[model samples]
Target: MSDQQKRLQMALDAAHMSIWDSRIVDGQVIDGTVSWSARGAALLGLEEKALTQAFRDFLACVHADDRARVLDVLQDGVQRHGGYDIQYRVIWPDGSEHWLAARAQVFTGASGQPERTLGIIWDITERTRQEIMIAERKELAEVTLSSIGDAVITTDPHGKTRYLNRMAEQLTGWTSQLAQGLDIWDTMPLADEQTGATLEHVAVKCLHQRQTIGTSAHTNLVTRDGRQVAIEDSAAPIWSRDGEILGAVVVFRDVSHERKLSQQLSWQATHDHLTGLINRRHFEQLVAGALHTAKEQGHVHALLYLDLDQFKIINDTCGHSAGDLLLQLLAKLLQSQMRDSDILARLGGDELGVLLPHCPMEHARQVGEQLRQSIRDFHFAWDSRSYELGVSIGMVEINQDSKSLSELLIAADQACYLAKEQGRNRIHVYQEADVMLAQRRGEMLWIARLKEAFEQQYFRLYAMPIVHLREGLESHDEVLLRIRNSKGDLILPGAFIPAAERYDMMISIDRWVIRAVCAHIQSVRDSLAPVEALVEQRRRAPALYSINLSGMSLADSGLQDYITEQFVQYAIAPEQVCFEITETAVIANLPKAQVFMHHLKALGCRFSLDDFGAGFSSFGYLKALPVDYLKIDGVFVRDIATNAINRAMVKAINEVGHVMGLKTVAEYVEDEATLAIIRELGVDYAQGHAVGNLRPLVAGLD
Candidate 1:
């Protein structure tokens, strides 16, 4: 090849240029596949032989949608000697599609008319596909913005409104066409909801800083038609591939409903559903806060605990609905009688708590008297019956000397009990010094008796037989602790148990009980050891003994180990001894009680949750406590024979206990009629004075 020809070939190769020469008068191809044509044809998945028929074949290969357009361009270039640039799709024999950019210029005759066209074509499919995809993604983004719930607006780097979705138009009261070219600040103006002051321009800030900017918490969007809404919005800048801020986009939503719902939920959490008074949980929180303030800032607050006298009689005589009505009426009356600064709460059941902040002792006592008199004067008429009510108020001055809320509450409760005992419808102030409060002298005397009893072994263990109500069920006996007064007269546990539990002496009493019971059980088991066959014959079933433990003992970390050691020393089977605790006790010290019960139960000892369905009993705790029996509280069983409500309560307790795979025990079964009702209710065991009077455990042993 000549140097000139080789240089031309090199230039074509450098530019990747393809040349085509055709006679457009008859559409004849003069030369095909000359400069880079071989390589271009190869890239198109076509052979060089096809170049000979390139004019007809290539024109036919042009995508059908672009064929006529390509023909028109060629006709204008050939006839008027005009230049043309066009991009069209090409299809190979395998049905593969490609894009080609074609440029042509016509060669003119002497008369200045075009005769033939010369064109260069090259494949540009990859770049064309990329551009198409970008357009498609932009279309998708527009559709998503218009379809979503949130309002969207886009702006340019200078904060000019570029686009608005459908939601944005509805919120701003401006159509996309009218909002275009307007400054974004003018299109979307937000102000503080409370202050009515215009907020910072979020779009301008986002665009200038190339970062996202959030609206203030109370941002209220102001619209064209003077409409406003609570909106939480943010603006983020649009960045180009070179990391330049090109524009900004703002997204926002109306959060008015969410804010209202959140406020409603907050209120419900603090107030009682029925009485509309602050619930116990929220009241306790207030007390804790007040305690802290009083200690830190030397503020004085007084707490008053009031109980409706004979509330159970009224509730039992009337239905629960009547009881509720009485409580509501009483709540309203007390609310009216108190000052606005005072806080009142329904601390569950018939108990109400009052907090008087920054009040002196004299004023607090006066307020307590007013509340008491108000309740005593109020007459509640439920159904056809008019019932008179009274209140027992306990007042305590909370100061820096108060150690904790729990202790203060207990002292107040005890003082309220003293008021009720001294005579109903009265108020009593709690005095820490023993001599001042003559009403509490009884409890102090009992404390002395308990000390004397524990020291002289004046405590005796008595067993009362638990008669099996079911025909073939086994029977057991519960051990009851009785104290002997200094005068040698026996005392019931109800008289002194309170005092023992009050001073945290129950843990020591519980240890003594465990030791005594285990010793008695060991002696019985050993007496019958020589004749194993006669052991079952001695009773309807093997004798199982139960002992009661106080709530304070449940909190003893070493109680379980102490029981285990007793079992080891006495050589007695844990199955022969069962521990009984009240539901209130378990609830008070749930973590420790749970650990104690589960540990001893693992060793084959049984547990009974006594006084079930008394107090604020939650069935939710039943699944957590593993007990062998549930003793129905005597309050329900005492009148079960005549009262339908009591019967239903007992029945429900039995059914739930059976469902949980535990036996049920009925207390206060004092007559044939009551025993018949409990037997029909499917109770597993019945224990009362009628079932068997308390007999000395050692004296009863043959």
Candidate 2:
């Protein structure tokens, strides 16, 4: 017990580091055993009884207003295990108010009653006041910076991130906790856009130099996950009152959108907004440069003047948006004809210019003819109407003998005018002795040839087998329509189909195929036993002959009636035929497509949505119309075995079809590996060159 009390007394003595006292409750003050030092008597200015002030007289020193609260706090602390602790004001006899911190512990008897109280008291007015002022200043600084608009960052002297404001955190893709203690340079990486190179550390350089450093133009900050953002900022050293550099502060703003706007404004100055091709002024500048090159360095070049034929007919009927789309599409086609070094531009409305450097007259003519034919073959679809248009291009070759750039441009324009006057779809070379011919003759020849072929029965039917993966020989052949030329040569359908489609000749062709397909089906049915025996193959799935229909035919009011008549005339079952429509055609004429599909479906005919997963693939129309098969586009199926992206696309399409209960047919499966991949992806049918080759639709009749 004595040892315990001695340790307790030592603790109280240590607590009185600056002032105060301790007491043994049973000791007598008159014995002088507890002497108040002379310093304590001097503090009170009383020598008599100064060495022996009763505890109540000491309470008098405590401010009267705080006496009751102090007593209650002490009583509450006396019941606890640690001690009684309080900070309160003390008023000396001289009326001086000072802060005092006091703490005490009470030792209890076996019955838990008070035995002896040991305590200490000290003055703490200066320390408490300083702490409160520091807290208020820190809070004020935090509030001001947090509300600032610009991004702010502060790093330590060692170039580690110490703080990041909200904007800074968003721009850097790093939060305060995650970025703190990380190298500031790594957190806010900067790159020189022009050179694709990293710049020096911003904060470290500022601290070393003790001055602000501004960033240069075309500087981009690389964020945490590697996105480059154009940014503008400056870094300055953070200094203390004594002019000692502590760390650095950086203020930056995101300028990515602003930079893009500036660049776009510059580009719009020289390029057409609609077609994104060089404008008239830029095209003329190129031609002028080409003429100079020919004169000074003996270099040869060519320039072409192209004017659209029948553009007004289509543009006036359809809206201007359609005309703009056609112009943009033609620009892409023109680009396909030239090398990257060649310049193609939209000279004006319905007119274009092409500049070919280091070219002879012969090569320029070929390119000019190629552009002319491409436009002649293109079928422009606009608002449920399809238009066939043409381009009349004039070629002018630049040589050392060329007088001037203005003269060459004039000659090219004159030749182009002649092409347009002659008929609209021909290319004319600006030769001194070249004769004027009627351009109308070119288009007249195609229309006349198509009419002759329709009368001569020159059109033929060919079918490529669509083999079901599980059914083997029990497959359908897709009926392809082809036309024979007068020379008895087999010209591919691509050669004449676009022209026919542009002129609204496909509906007639589609009718002929449906009629022929019925005959083909009947022939196969009559010889099924012998044919299967000849090929040594047995069928599993029911045979259905599939035929393609165009968007124009789908919207034709008379097409549905003509189809009904053909079905009755051929005595063919609707179950034996499948109508295939391109996805683009369906999207273009949705209401007509739905009505046509539903009408045929009512008659037990199957429908296959061909060329799905081609472009703008969407399930938005899937629920609107009913379809049996989703034919994967050849472009996607052709490379699934080797391409990861193709595999993902094919897998996604297959899953969507299966969910809708539609069988999927993979096209362009030309190899065994591709077939393996398609089969693994759960496609129901495989149709392509690998499955079968094109054959005469009527084998025995031919």
Candidate 3:
């Protein structure tokens, strides 16, 4: 080849192209007149000698599926005296299908008649394979997008909608055809569910930020027909292979049911289901907020604790259903009497709390009275019964002086209790002095009742068995004191002991108990059968009686002499009586207690340090006291089975008592679990309901 021809041939060879030429006659390619370069022959899988071939022969090499279209293109080019470019599949001699692209022009002579055609051909099987794969993937992606359940919308980088899936059409109430090319915000309008304010499109944010953006939980989509649909969605920017911003894809779904359920649970958590009012827990939060405002802004507020009177009577006369109806009616009445700013809540079981913000104490009292009157006037009718209800309200001002939420509530409750005590259907304002005055009044009442019991001889003695843990060890009874009211009801000492102690009557009560106990023991000794007397004499010791003494009695100089007189008068064995003194009493009157205990010890009377571990200084005071037994405080023994710290405390006390040569007793052993634990801890004696039920000392002796 010449130099220019060689360069042209080299360029075609570098491009992997082959040149071909053919003569055209009468608007058709001449048969047996087609020729091509060796590369073209090789691309067709033909021998070198096959470079020149008839037009029909070359057509034979074209794939059967593409041959007709190729021939039509060639014929049309020749007739139109124009050029054509086309791609067609070719089957090589090896039975492998390949792709080729050919371009040719129909050259015209001076007379404007078609003369010849020339073309360049190249193998495009690899590029064609890639294009096919890309088409298939695109088809698959379209199918997948249409099939998914979540509403999907694709937007251009400019935030204009490009495509919408089937779900998107249903959710937005807009067809894909109409949504195309529209702004994404217009197609999928959103607003805040709570505020009804327009929400910025997440797709726009994703496009701007070039990252994923999620819509808030409160977002609601405004459909085409102006209906709102709760939705949760996310938008992610689509990036091109070169990392350029292509568009964004938004995926969302309906969350109406979930949102509804969440709201219901939230409401139930803060509200009382029975009355539809806020519960105590939520009420406290609001009161705390009010308290904060009062302290910070110098604003005055008031809290009212209302307890419904006669509610229990109605509940007991009727069923709980009637009680519930009464409560519901009362709640409405109370709500109606309060201002819009006032918050009312059900503080559990016929009790309601009211919080009035920015109100003075006087105004709060008036409001409380109004609520009380409203409840008093409201008659509730249930199941053919009409009953009048009354409310006792306690009011406390919340101001800079307010200490804490809990203290305010407690003060209000105390005031309410005082109102009920004075008379029902009244409102009482809380004052610091109210608590002390109320306590005094209650103590006075208890004192009067105690004096009546003393004059009437209503005092009674009960005993609980204190059983020895080990076999063959003697068991004894701890004497407990009770009082009989004029109504013939038994009353435990707890109801009156504190008052008796505060008023200096505990010593009198103790003296009475000592004498009564001695007389009872003597009577029991007299009543004993001959066989029982013989058995008692044969035993190691007589039946022992443990008695409790007040701290005041312990300090009385003449108490020991009185006790000795009782013992001698009854001809009772001094060894049979044991005196129980609390840890606090001994600590309070250590010197006097020691002298009295030493005097009693000389007379063969035993002493036990009751409620030993309660003072938390048992070991310290135990060494100084003359005691035979250490009573583990019921506080620790009550939960010794489940509380690790209590168990450890009891164990330590028992071990220390054992080491000090004093027998250890576990008190308040109410259950098998507690009894088992103390037994396992090696307590010497167990006393409580678990060992034996409390019974009248006389009956027990008999």
Top-lDDT candidate index? 3
- Across 1-702, the per-residue lDDT of candidate 2 in tens digits comes to 599877865664575332344343433211112234443443443452337566567667778888777766755555563457887767876787767776667666676655445555555768877876888887776666677877888988778999988888899899978999999888899888778698887777898888998865788889999998898878998888998877899888898877877786567568876688999888898899999999999999998999987886675456454676898898888798789999998987788999999989888888887888888889998878788988888888898998987888877886886777677789888876442332354356667777887898878888888888886556688988766667765545655776678677888878888878877666666666876745543435457789998888899888778877877876778888899998889999999889889998999899999889766656777778789989987767776776566687799999999999999999878778998998898899998666776777865322
Residues 1-702, candidate 1: write the lDDT tens digits. 999978976876686656655554343232221233575565456775324344556677788998888777776666555778989898888999989887878776676655566767777899899999999999899999999999999998899999999999988888999999999878998888889998887788788777899764788889998888888889998989998888999998888877666555566568765577998889888888888888888889999889887676676566454676788888888899888989999987788999999998899998998998888788887777788888988888788888898877877776777787789789888877622454367667767787888888788888888877755546588998887666766666655776777777888988998999889877776776566747465646567899998888889888888989999999878988889998878999999999888899999999998999875454788889999989998867866776665687799989989999998999877677888898888899998766776678877331
lDDT for predicted candidate 2 compared with the true structure = 0.77
TM-score of 3: 0.59
**lDDT for every model?**
0.80, 0.77, 0.87
**Mind sharing the TM-score for model 1?**
0.59
Total colliding residue pairs, candidate 3: 1
Hey, what RMSD does candidate 2 come out at? 15.7
Best to worst by TM-score, what's the order? 3, 1, 2
Quote the lDDT for 166 in model 2: 83
Q: Could you tell me how far off, in angstroms, the CA of residue 498 lies in candidate 1 after the best superposition?
A: 8.5
Q: TM-score per candidate, in order?
A: 0.59, 0.51, 0.59
Which stretch of 10 consecutive residues in model 1 shows the poorest summed lDDT? 27-36
The candidates, ranked best first by lDDT, are 3, 1, 2
